[model samples]
Target: MSISPVNCPNTDCYWSAHGIPDKYTEARAWHLAAHRAEEHGELLTAEQVAYATRAGHTLPNCARTAAAVAAAPEPIPARWDRTVILPEHPNGDLDGQTIVCCITDDGTKRPIGLFLDDEHREALGLLLVDPNGEDEEHATLLAEVQRLKTELAQAQEDIAFTERNTLPELRRTVEHHQDGKKRWRDRAQKAEARVAELEAERHTTNEALSDAAQQLRANSDRITELEAELTKYVGKEPTIAEEMEYLSGCLNAVRDLCDATEKQATRWEHPLPVPEWVETVRAATDGVRPDDPNDNRHRILVDGKGNGWISVCSDEGTEWVVPIQPAAHVEQDVRDVADETGSLREIGRCW
Candidate 1:
């Protein structure tokens, strides 16, 4: 059988411009023409579009001119033909004849007017047709049935095995997972409860600390107030140097009074009235008179009647006195002088 190559409708395509003989089959030419029209920007003629459509080739959005569509020829019907070499006649003559081929419903070619003798026709029929086609088909069907039966038996066994093993194992696995989930849920609940308890404890502790801080602040304020009251009552405590300065001033005052008294006694030529406490101090100091009055150590004593007496001491343990008489009207005691000065040191009461 000889099949002629179909020419591509698109002159730009390789099949039409440069392909070798037998390069494009009828279906291949129509497909390439449609592909060129769709993808390569090549336009097909209206007649080619109609022919490709009839040949079951689809061309999407293919470009065709309206004039071409109007001038398109009618669609030609498809035909199949074959040129066969004729056999020699029994009379030794070569007969020349063309065989007409027709397409069947299944798209196969059936040649009409093929002449053959009865013996040759029978021999050709025997060669073309399979003698054991029905037997082979039956054997194939039997093998297929046996295979299906074996598969069905295996499927039944698999179903039974799944029912016996896989289903129960799956159920146990699901139950185990469910139990684990429950245990985890319980643990999460317990942990949440513990966290809540800790939060409450922390809140309580914060409140307690706040109360303690407030109490400490109040105590500190009270301490400041008490210190202020103490300062008001006792005055500021003197440093050692300030106290020494005060005591030195008191000693100087007593010495001055003693010097004045001794000068008065020497000028008057009459014995001055000395308090009895001054006589006692003179007895205790052995009556040794000191030349430098400023160099002598003097202790000023105030009796209960507010009589101030200066007791003067020398290197020989001798004592001298200068009596300081209080006012005739006011009766002040030794403690009253101590309260007034704060620097006076009282050893004993002078009568």
Candidate 2:
């Protein structure tokens, strides 16, 4: 828009105020602008609005800009940059249409409407056809696309790093390390079950042995009592009643002893299990309890041979079956004392 003011005949009157009123020139002359129709009732069509603006009578003030457009006499929006009458192409179709842009003439108060081919119009559609801007929207969109691409790349890199390094390590811990723990747990469970069975058998055997021992003690006492009675009777050259009573007492003692002997025989029939059953239990465990005290170490067994196993043992000497050796127990310390280190050094040298 140029600043050298031209004389406006209807000065401050938005319309041209001097053009012939036609189909497009709804109204003209000074401050008053009206959409006077060639026919009544219909608001001026957009085609009419453009035509009127170009004629310099309808919206003469708008040089494609609304304020400039409002300077026109007519009440029309500036969405219409301009309009063009279509011309027939050599192909005989009106397919190649011309779009007139209401380009503001820098030095003149007039709107310089220029023609655009169909292709240009399509491009203009992409760049808003109004205000006649180009590629501005696409430029904004392109920047957003670039930002998304950069973010996506970083995310993919993080994923790749995890797969190559962190994920593999995690998987190894889960699959191999954790699996080893499960195997140990299973072995421990088996050992425990065996120990329980052996313990039950041992309990029963001990109970029988105790009963036998009690019976034997009772029998011994009875025999002593009978001997005392016989001693007194022997001195008196014991009468028939005394002799008979002593004999009866001796016989009763023999009978009690016999019962005790039978019970003891049965009880002792199954001897205490050899250490191997315990060792087997331990060997079954491969006896390595690095975490417990030896005093807590215990052996369990079934009464019969080859029938028992060891449960948890405190002694590190025990062994258990495993694919790999059990991990050595580690002691956590904030720091090893210097004196302790010196002692260890001396021990190492001596050893």
Candidate 3:
């Protein structure tokens, strides 16, 4: 499965005039361009019209970059850079051989091409001679080749006919005539014109079909190439889908933890009136959440075991979770706050 790239030569067709766009120069893209030309009556550039080898395979003027890239040969090793035309090794079997070899500045030989031993050389000498009295067999083979070529041509014609007309339509055309003899005669001219139009349309349809089939094959080849390349990195890195799944799992775990903590925090019992210092600490530590309905205080979560945590935001715009301890811990903190005030006054004392 190989794709031969075609260049769109139409200077005015989409982006062809300025240059063969990188995207359009690809095998599939160019094949689609060809289909458009055949199926949609699109105009091609002058060079494409003039130089296309097939109905839709045209080479555009702007194909220089693509052509150069394609035409560039695979690099040969430096050792085989030089060639010698059958001069040094003047055996009859090697008469016209152009041997690739490494040649030093002073013309010392570094062998690269055929190096035949004496026995091998003798065998090749005998094998090169034509068999005696085989002229008739050669002539028969040539005729068979020509016959096969003719059969291939006929097969192509059959395929074109099959594409252009259905079997039933062909049978009807062969078996019936329209109206009476005179009526048929009168319609003959119009029938001929219609036939010509249909033939042209059929040709266009065939070209479009060929272009589409070629593009499909090219796409299949490209998909196979990509899949093969992907296999090379199968275990090296996680795919995007795998990464997303892992991240989603981590997020769900965090949400569950938050939910559990919230449940536990609500399980704790409290007296009707909270202490003044505790109220002051709650007011000071309450988070601001303008967008939340419960914006008056911190959002807290608890678990089944009565373990809980509070979610709060600091003035610096950072969010954190603080673990909830036993009520005694809170009472002690409240007393400490009261004692820190000057003269150790009542809960109403101002710092």
Lowest lDDT 10-residue stretch of candidate 2: 342-351
Please provide TM-scores, in order, for all candidate models, with all chains considered together.
0.32, 0.24, 0.20
What is the full ranking by TM-score, best candidate first? 1, 2, 3
Off by over 4 Å in 2: 1-140, 216-351
lDDT of 2 by residue, 131-209 (tens): 4434668667557768887897566545533432354356557899889999999999999999999999999999999
**lDDT of residue 110 for candidate 1:** 43
What digit string (tens of lDDT, one per residue) describes model 1 on residues 214-321? 999999999999998888868578865566566556655665665566566666667766545543443333223333545434556543334455553333543344
For residues 29-122, what per-residue lDDT tens digits would candidate 3 score against the true structure?
A: 5444444454344545444443445433433322343344566896434443433333355542345443334533334544546444555444
Q: How much lDDT does each candidate structure score?
A: 0.53, 0.44, 0.47
Q: Scored by Cα lDDT, where does model 3 land? A: 0.47
Tell me the deviation in Å of residue 238 in model 2. 17
Instruction: Give me the displacement of residue 154 in model 1, in angstroms.
Output: 0.8
